[model samples]
Target: MAPGEKLDPLPDPFILQPPAFHPVVPYVTTIFGGLRAGKMVLLQGEVPLDARRFQVDFQCGCSQHPRPDIAFHFNPRFHTTKPHVICNTLRGGRWQAETRWPRLALQRGAGFLTLFLFGDEDVKVSVNGKHFLHFRYRLPLSRVDTLGISGDVSVKAVAFLNSNPFVEGGSEYPAGHPFLSESPWLEAPCSRALPRGLWPGQTITVRGLVLPEPKDFTLSLRDEAAHVPVTLRASFADRTLAWVSPWGRRQLILAPFLFYPQRFFEVLLLCQEGGLQLALNGQGVGATSLGQQALERLRELRISGSVRLYCVHC
Candidate 1:
């Protein structure tokens, strides 16, 4: 050491060093340790046992002031193999856990990693390098002791750093849904070529011709008999559309410029018992109900003259 000399950034004290022996064995070696930052271990082997028997233990910081950062356990007998993250925070000297799974989890073979951070207002969970959850006020300062991970299967990689977590949009909506159409509006001379009949549990795809106005308009399904109208409005502002139920008159502003004109735009409306479910192409957008009045008695299922750029599908 010399005076007035700057010191190099010290290597991560938590870095996991090479193990002297095989850190993990078949079923007996359930816990593995010796990383400066944290530790990762796998459970569940070829042995015939209940999935719940698999457990993970996490010891944070140092042995003198060890903090139980996180732990995970699963059982296979009663549940199927699915990826998920469980979060917890210490409140009033008590630990509370919250389980969160991304919408993408509905798909098969999706794996996710849980990140715990300090000074973070929310827990950021990522799957396949895509951020999914932005949970607010989940982990507090006092509750975060040490960060660790454990699972039933082997982890590809395990590392931690001082960074903020965030949530990124998934493939729930096609890229074109928000980018292709801008300031989408319904064209005039709009007519429901399909006959008005009992559309119970049916989805009616509406195709209309867009005019040169370059303005956004709402496609509304009105049951004249009940004075209820369900509207779906699309806009270029966010490159997405929303459904607005007849919950009294509502208004939404669209972008000033038009993106597509004289082009055919399509939306699907699902027929339900009391209301209709609206969606863009095949993605679920929103829904609206028919209220006490029976929607079957509708005389006209045409677009109401009242048009807007905003509609929240019920």
Candidate 2:
């Protein structure tokens, strides 16, 4: 990238079975292939300014008269003076004891990313990119086949990932899984054309496993003139992440580099009005500012380095 060439933006890449975008409130859907260890459900949306509260429930079925059993109920109560979260289970139409968490990491009227990771004994919930709490399984997870969300909240996307992205050969996803079967792994040094170019509010997700004995890998965004506008490098040996440009390279040392060899990672790049926000495994990492014109020039995404890419959702 040229020193003053201006960093370009990354466009929205074509995706297979992209997550449900802008679903109606009080949404419900079957948990494809059912819940199992290593699977994950990701909800991305904004908490409305006037939001009172919201709940995410895992149910056995959508029955009404006999009310479907709730395997897990995760509710964030913002209406209360002291914001908190309540977790519980419902069996035989009766609610069980409630577990309360006194902290609320979500902000009103802001975008948020929440993840529910299914494990053997509990479900790990993370808000944005930070680990929040775990809800032990009262009802067997095997009995949970449907997901329901209701209350004062707006949902942008609801995605189900069949397997953990961090483990090598984790759980095997069923054939035709949208995340895997459709957008299969791509070889290293991969490059894809970004026809639409990135726009404000667009996001790009790169999921991959770092190779053992890794050196470094770079993700770059180039313009139509083939000039790199933005480039980020993760150096395993140096334990640093660098922003490269014609001017020079700026590096930040991470106590323990997140891009370690044999590690699984999901990187999210969110395009904003005048900058790009980056996150690793759901945690905010870094961001860079660029002019509006510069962001409009981004036309391609190039992923080259020491990593095996499982998928790229632009």
Candidate 3:
């Protein structure tokens, strides 16, 4: 532990585990303990074909009389031809100024997953594994103890993820191939840790299903340095992989194609002792030089594509 650094505890890994899948609309639930900075909430749902607007709210209390104070009000309006996201706060049944983003991150009738990354200053909304927008904090974050959602949306499920690795669950460091149960995850296009940080003998895994209407997808690793090393991409056309780096190095890797409606693929990437190794399914596909300085500098794992990202083990 660093001197004077606070060891913030993470919520129990099982805290947000839903009892069962919810495929209904106008859903509401408590966020267990409350809302806190560094907690990410995942909402998987689909907008109805005739949907107009839907709202996701973070409430300080779950009272119904005279209405509870809302800490964060995230509403997506797609009524008319135009669509946008409105962010606001409500106190004493009154709303404050609103901020709007002119983008519809969710599509009608398409199952989508949105992540609300709660931070000290604001909450960043990412839809379908991409950065969307951020809304600043308008109320004391400590007061937010409940989550509520309503309007024209079909909710598949919801989960909460606390970023700290050492807090409640024993996800800190898993031996051998860490199963899906021992990792902190986001929808995708996200950065998560391996045990704690980059270390020797650590392995990286990404498992997802390629969508039928897919073109290609990419996964990259970054560092504080300007040079980001090892970006792995798979081409849907010929079942080939592109192993490249931000420094302009490319290695074409060919892997056998698998056909089916599922269209599943698992890519394992690792950077250790010798160099970078990438494998698809069980095939050794490509490699990249693992610079010595890049060891501890390797910060995150990112995947972007038309696939339902299952798990990313870093």
Best by TM-score: 2
Instruction: Give candidate 2 misplaced runs (Cα > 4 Å).
Output: 1-18, 165-314
Q: Order candidates by lDDT, high to low.
A: 2, 3, 1
- Candidate 3: list runs displaced more than 4 Å: 1-20, 164-314
Backbone clashes for every candidate come to 18, 4, 1
Model 3 clashes, total count: 1
Would you list the C-alpha lDDT of every candidate in the order shown? 0.36, 0.74, 0.66
Model 2 clash count equals 4
lDDT of 2 by residue, 50-94 (tens): 988999999999877899999999998888999999999999999
Candidate 1 local lDDT, 186-245, one digit each (tens): 323244433354367555544333455544655655554545456666553343445565
TM-score of every candidate: 0.30, 0.53, 0.52
Minimal lDDT window, size 10, model 2: 8-17
Q: Report clash pairs, candidate 2.
A: 7-229, 11-198, 13-314, 129-282
What TM-score does structure 1 among the candidates reach?
Answer: 0.30
Better of 1 and 3 by TM-score: 3
Model 1 alpha-carbon drift over 4 Å, by segment: 1-187, 193-197, 208-213, 225-228, 235-240, 245-264, 291-293, 303-314
For model 1, the local distance difference test gives: 0.36
